[model samples]
Target: MVVPEPGLPAAVTIYEVGPRDGLQNEQGIIPTATKAAFVRRLLAAGLPIVEATSFVHPRWVPQLADAADLMTALRAELGDAAAELPVLVPNERGLDRAVELGLRHVAVFASATDTFAERNLNRTVDSQFEMFAPTVDRALAQGMDVRGYVSMCFGDPWEGAVPIDQVVAVGTRLLDLGVGQLSLGDTIGVATAGHVRALVAAFAAAGIGPERLALHFHDTYGQALTNVHAGLQAGVTTYDASAGGLGGCPYAHSATGNLATEDLVWFLTGLGIEHGVDLTAVAATSRWMAAELGRPSPSAVVRALTPPTE
Candidate 1:
């Protein structure tokens, strides 16, 4: 006796964060120029917001040892791109590198679950937020857009279940610090539909309206799209997805890819929602990326688009 998924707004925005989140976790470090091509292809394919790289120290994330170089190359190639390519900046040093290169947008992250904060960022809750404050101020002062990410909003891999208030308190601080969007991440893909509804409701009651939120769900347990429905029902219109379910949380052991962007678009369109993205082209783009990455794609849309075997 459950209700059908509620209708979404006439239009919704999908921010693609695959390049930064998806590629960073790979054990092999993709070449700098190769990373540039990933950004170029996604931008050419017309993704609205592509998180290009992270400015963490090379020792921390050797995968992005060439963050500055990638930016220089991508920025030059922005000539025909229809989207914004931003980087992830976790603190002052990371943000400083971004500012030095005249970057316009960057994302910062924290965890609703304290265990993740320590495991992921190796800092306590308050210390991590403090690390972000000056970076937020500098980015705002420089007229850059900031997207704040809260990992494990629904449940944590190590911490069992995160309290709703902790999610709200951290999210509010980021929003208060001038983040244009707060992306709630089901980092471990452990959220059920019921869990999704409860957390979104809790966020709403905390005076943090739906407009400022986006859901970033992982598909580890195969219930991500169902959780997306629950998220839509709770009034969140924006979503963060990867082109071919290409991203995962590095800190979450055994956590799998995100809800595929093409799958999300397909789901929304089938339900008569308007997302203004070209699904056919996106599927093609996913195929291209999968080929480049030398891996089989996890996206259902790409699978559907694959030619039938003889």
Candidate 2:
């Protein structure tokens, strides 16, 4: 008898967050020119979904201070492709900005952990949703694509352990708010394969499933690959990854970062799954970005496959 593979599919859509999520955490201000070019290159690599930028307060996130400028530039530069660029709006104000700029897809964020809620959003976990209620309503009313983020699904930096019920309740509320999809995030990368399996099972029991959910994970402790395997086994096909493993949770301290898109593509490719992304180009771009940041490439595959410059 032959053993069949796991939830390996013929194709997958990678929502690229490197421009917003990846660059937001960098210590310095990335030049607007470089940021725009990054988007151009990533889109050129055949990535269908690329999160362009966040229209948030510069005081809260200085790195994205050029959000407006970047948004305008990407749209003008990409033209028709600009339709695929989605911006993140943390609240009503941010959403307003995105709408004014004529963006069709936008993301709203929340946390499932009390500790992160207080530190990150300066409100209780539930209150953050309340704050976002009006914006979500406005977005749905305007016929926009809304993606809800439920962060800290696996663990928390301050709270240490997070409850499964909290995640379900928060996710359920987001769904009730009419979110087209819920992206469960393991913010600090402390999640194990067993925990991944359990949480997906819990979400399933609570009326959430792969068809309406996405998984975002950080590779801080090196369990990201295994977590991907687990998410697939749980029937999830959509996953979020950064280029070259380039992002980390801002609310998370001493953590590594997001699962590299290149790594995810490599894994899927090995499984004979079509990710519709150019892995070779992804590796080159990862190397370039790592060089500009003056840091070691976090992606092991990139380090091995990319030829060394003399």
Candidate 3:
């Protein structure tokens, strides 16, 4: 039983990333219908924001190659509810694809470390900004809300222990480019509670308020939840989580599952915070997704709460 921290917000907004980030890293290709169904389930479970797909070149993220088809299907099925979907766009071309599909929300990803930028995007950190600038600008100009993702903000697989100032600098650039919110990712899940507090403090000191920041933690070291608790204490009200704890970075081989939505919901509920997510529905979705992946869920909450079959 966890006690509610006095400074924590009464409510938090969870940005569900399972559809894009989670399935992108899977070994097996999930059918387009299944992916679409997954998104519907997540919405039905009450997640306000769901990352639907990435428009990166198919050669890069083959799992989400069906971005167009998936979005088309979802737009048709969800109608007005489709407004909640956000797709990841790598550049002008990706953004064009998203725009063509009538997407109102999009996300652009960047890394705080040069090595990761080179390996992941085949460009230096600065070059990535140049590549992403036009997309960010165009998206915002078109009246679409943009979200920025700063990968390896806590620690990089190649560089290790990225400076908080460096992350802040990159994040500030993203904000300057007109991203409504910036999600700081502990890409390899190396952050502790202390690190989370310090990083949030640094960002706050730099004039970026908690309202403009979100935390995305991987559960590689079993510290995702602890860091989330610390994030709550720091007044960050937005977080990125995956259902069924699905997903890991293909570039960062050692990285593992993302912080599970179920686990975070359990923590938030125990702390008496209002997240507007149904724990049982999310757990059932996790169980169903785990079955799709042919594995047990990595989330402890899902495991313990899931009922046995007769």
- Global fold similarity of model 3 (TM-score): 0.98
Worst 10 residues of 3 by lDDT: 1-10
Ten residues in a row with the worst lDDT in model 2?
Answer: 1-10
lDDT value for model 2: 0.85
Best model number under lDDT: 3
Residues 52-137 of candidate 3: C-alpha lDDT, one tens digit per residue: 99998888888988999999999899996685599999899999988888889999999899999988899888889998889998
lDDT of 2 by residue, 1-310 (tens): 2233755655667888899998888888899989998898898888888898888788878899999889888878977567558888988999888888778898988889878888778889878988788989998888889999988998887888798888889999988998898999999899999998888899899877777878898998899999998888888888998899988866677556789999988887777766799988978888888888998788888888878671
Q: At residue 165, what lDDT does model 3 achieve?
A: 93
Order the candidate numbers by TM-score, best to worst. Answer: 3, 2, 1
Candidate 1 weakest lDDT stretch, 10 residues: 1-10
How well does each candidate superpose onto the true structure, as a TM-score? 0.93, 0.96, 0.98
Task: Count backbone overlaps in model 1.
Answer: 0
Stretches > 4 Å off in candidate 1: 1-6, 80-83
Q: What residue runs in model 2 are displaced by over 4 Å at the alpha carbon?
A: 1-7
In candidate 2, how many Å is residue 156 off?
A: 0.6
The local lDDT score (0 to 100) that residue 119 gets in candidate 3 is 80
Candidate achieving higher TM-score, 2 or 3:
3
